[model samples]
Target: MKFLRDILDKVKPNFEKDGKLHFLHSTFDAIETFMFVPNHTTKRGAHIRDGIDLKRTMFIVIIALVPCLLFGMWNVGALHYAAQNIDSTLLENMLYGAMKVVPIIVVSYLTGLGIEFAFCQVNGHPVNEGFLVSGMLIPLIVPADIPLWMVIVATAFAVIIGKEVFGGTGMNILNPALTARVFLYIAYPVEMAGEIWVSGIKEGLVDAASGATALGVLGGKDLEAASNYSVNVMDAFMGFIPGSIGETSVLMCLIGAAILIVTGIGSWRIMLATVIGALGMGLILNAVGGNPYYDLPAYQHLLIGGFAFGAVFMATDPVSAAHTTTGKWIYGILIGVLTVLIRVFNPAYPEGIMFAILFMNVMAPLVDNYVVKANIKRRLNRVKA
Candidate 1:
């Protein structure tokens, strides 16, 4: 560590003002900080410094995502072989999965960080580590077999349009990862979904092989039909099923959630409220009993699709989600309720968390405003009384 720090110190001068590499100072700073925490501190004024900074916070979320990433990679390999009735060892599965998953992750980081660094150079500001999390998230949210070119386009779209357009990461209204997903979804609906769930899966390879996800099966039929198709609670929860790279495993998502909550980085209120809202809405649909999907158990909603992943990671994005304590509950509940509603109502497309989170991102500020105003009013009334 000391050796690396010394090397950075030696090269730092060249990237300082009026130096030969001054033009790339932002880029250098990004690399340096990533390797080591900034030692420079305030010399004046009374400032309360926390143990962690933005980069550190982003890394914490990345740490939380590690379990999901590893599981997703193995699951991809498992599904790929299972689709063709090939029985392979765990190492073989992971090796194949790594070949597919790693490139997407590389493209995501390179594309996003390249754009961010370029913006920083042009804007003459420090490069924010915001894309660190978003880059990992993009790869995880996408299918393992998605084209590299599409990832480039979607990542560029996410960084430039979803984030940079709104004045960089902290200023963005929507989650960049979800933005990339939505872009892919809208631009290439056929590629974004369906058989992309499994890598290199051939058609009619076996009598009992299907590439469709649990949610995909549920989209067209009732709970019983979906179950009959082998979409059950245990398989989905354990992530031994076909779905997006990281979203297939509810257990992994919960593990990520635990890390986030333990580190005090993610909002537990949002997580809990989202779950409650989803169950509440699911119960209502069950009461109506108008369709097979409506008959799905409320608890099952948390176990399938991207509900757990979205609730744990996407909905709790600090920048896009509601900030106020009371507002978080509202923001999260709406996300959960809307997700179930969209899934139940729109059988053709049941992956509603993406749209629901984006919609709530727009409304988060409004929710916060109302929460703030209500708090102020209540305080004034209490004083008068």
Candidate 2:
């Protein structure tokens, strides 16, 4: 480590302010800061210096996502082989899935980071670490068979418009990963939707079949008719159902949620509120029971689609989520309710978590403002009393 540090120190002068390679300062600093914590400290103003920097924070999130990524890879391969009735070992499945998934991840990081670094270099600002998490997230949420060119374009759009245009990182209103996902989903619906969720099916080993997802099956018709296409609740819970790479597995999402909660990086209030909101809405729909989809159990909604993944990973983004405690509750509940409403009412789009989260991200500020105003009013009343 010391040898590596010494090498960085030696080459650092070339990337410094008046040096020959000054234009590449952001690139050099990005690598150096990643390898070691910056030693520079606040000298004057009151500041709470801590070991947990933005890089560490983002790295923790990536660590939390590991279980989902690994499981998604295995699931992709397993689904491919299962469709063909080709009995293969777990290792083979994982290896095959990795071949498909890894390239997307690499392209996402390379493209997103390239844009981010370029923006930083051109603007003479320190490189921000927000892309570290967004880069990994974009691949996870999209269909496994999505084109690489789409991923590149979506990533560039996310970094430039969704983030950089809004002043980057902490200033952005929308989650960059979600922004990229929504762009692809809307602009290239053909590629982002339909039977493309699972990879390896194009090998001609299996007969043609409807690649509709579990939620799609449920949303397509009433309960009795849909049961023919419905997956077992246990399968959905364990993630044997077809969907996005990281979103199908409720078990993995819970595991990731636990890591985020234990690390104190994610908001428990928002999570609890989201579940409560969903359950409440589910119960209401069940009682009214106009549609067979509404008759589906409330708890099952939590397991299917991207509800769990969005609640854990996407909705809880510190930058985009509600800041006030009360606002978090309102924001989460709205997301839950909206997700259910959109999924049930809009049959065209079976999954609604992405739209729900992004919509809430837009409304988070309004929620926070109301919460803050109430807090101020309460404080004033107490003083008068």
What are the RMSD figures for all models against the true structure?
2.0, 1.6
How far is 192's C-alpha from truth in model 2 (Å)? 1.8
Instruction: Name the best candidate (by lDDT).
Output: 1
What are the TM-scores, per candidate, against the unseen true structure? 0.95, 0.96
- Clashes in model 1: which pairs? 222-292
TM-score attained by model 2: 0.96
**Model 2 misplaced stretches (Cα beyond 4 Å):** 221-224, 227-229
In Å, residue 289's CA in model 1 sits off its true spot by: 0.5
- Residue 378 displacement (Å), model 1: 1.0
The sequence of per-residue lDDT tens digits that candidate 1 reaches over residues 1-385 is 9999899999999999999999999999988977886787899999998888897799899999999999999999998888777999999899989999999999999999999999999999899888999999999998887889999999999999999989997999999999999999999987776666778853444333377776777786556666565447789889998888998899999999999999999999999999999999999999998666778888988888888999999999999999999999999999999999998888766698889999999999999999999999999999999
The alpha-carbon lDDT assigned to residue 257 of candidate 2 equals 91
